[model samples]
Target: MSVIEKFSLKDSLAIVTGGAGLLGKQHVEALIEAGADVIIFDINENALEETKKYFLKKYNTDVLSLKVDITNEDEILKAKEKIFKHFSKFPNILINNAAIDPKFEKNSAVNKSRLENFDARQWNLEISVGLTGAMLCSKIFGAEMAKNKRGIILNIASDLGVIAPDQRLYKQDGLKDEEQNVKPVTYSVIKHGLIGLTKYIATYWADKGVRCNAFAPGGVFNNHSDEFVNKIAQLIPMKRMANLDEYKASVVFLCSDASSYMNGATLNMDGGRSVW
Candidate 1:
């Protein structure tokens, strides 16, 4: 088969949580390019509608936009029902891309102190949104995929989850930026924990013909400052942050039959950052 045909997702049903975000929108677009029917799920209604219009106009394909608070089970169920009612089947691919940065709120994990101010509450919020939410979504989506006896799941993780941060790498940003680095306790801890969950579900659900995997992307240059991006780029072997196409390739692989043998695997699309 040709390269495109090998990875084609024609007629597949895809659900991409957090489809309104920068990286999420790229993912949705790539899936649509690969010929899958997509459902974009996000809590931000305005952004979701904007994404829907853009995709419809650009791709001339029907895309569903769901206003869903992923952390809430009832809300997720309602979205699922809507998806089923419209598509008439379970999603063949689920992309768990919904996550919150802990440093967004001023009172949040903004780390005013270095090696001294480690707030548990700040850490907990990261776990709630980044880790716990992914787990819950996996549970619901996996069950649905199981019932159908076929599907692919790709969970988004960070390279920081694999390796701890170095204080030296945070010099340009000062101690405050260092403290707020994504490698801080909560986000890294949860991401590491997410890998464990991915393995477990992949093994336990192997018999059901469902595959679970993770894409550990390094320093996506979305919403991060130039100094922050530059500081991070130095540590990576490739000396660059990830592009949308790189992230999209790995995501599409996890959702396609091309990666059929890759279950319980954590594909690091970090430009060799994790290797260092």
Candidate 2:
């Protein structure tokens, strides 16, 4: 196929978890722009409906939005049934984008997210949403894709997954050492775990025509404090946080035939942060 044709997702069906969030919405748009029928699974009913209406108006593509709790197997199975009812078949692409990454912004009231005083309950909640949720989705949705002997699973990871979290980026002054709102330990753990999950899924389904891969991105600029942005910029060779739309092209490449031969790989598109 020509390189241009390789990028086309005209006949593809993609399901993006957390598809109503900041980055997830962009993933939906990218897939739709590539001519793929898209489905969104997010727990936020309001955001999900809004995303569905907005995208429906903007693109002339089939878009289904479902309110799903990814951590629950029953919910995931129900979602699969709905897919069959609506789209007549299972999706070829599953974007494991749902996560509970607590922001460690300065002055934020983050008492339990700090590792020093982190609550075990909070850990379980984040892990369930970030790691376990992805697993459940993969297990339920991936089986259907395998029956067709073709699929792509893309896990949304972070630059911190490849490298250790630089706690300094989140440090706030005038607080006790215990009160310092460092990057939550759960965030790093979950991201790193996703990369591991990607590898396992890749090998497990290689013979079934499935490709599992991931991408590690640096901070995306979302009106973060100038202090935080500048601090992170210094670590990246590009010297700037990524724009909200920067990941759209990469997602299209990975989810479409463009990355047909690619599996068990993770592209670290982190503005040179991991290398630095």
Top candidate on lDDT is 2
lDDT digits (tens) for residues 1-276 of candidate 2: 899999999888999999999999999999999889999999999999899889868875557999999988899899899999997999999999998767544555656657767888888999999999999999888887888998999999999889999888877778866677778888889999999999999999999998999989888999999999998988999999999999999999999889999999998998899997
lDDT tens digits, residue span 231-255, model 1: 7778888888877666777677778
Candidate 1 runs further than 4 Å off: 1-3, 104-116, 172-183, 223-226
lDDT of each: 0.80, 0.90
Choose the strongest candidate by TM-score.
Answer: 2
Per-structure clash totals for the candidates: 0, 0
Please give each candidate's TM-score: 0.89, 0.96
Off by over 4 Å in 2: 103-110
Residue 93 alpha-carbon offset, candidate 2, angstroms = 0.5
Model 2 lDDT vs. the true structure?
Answer: 0.90
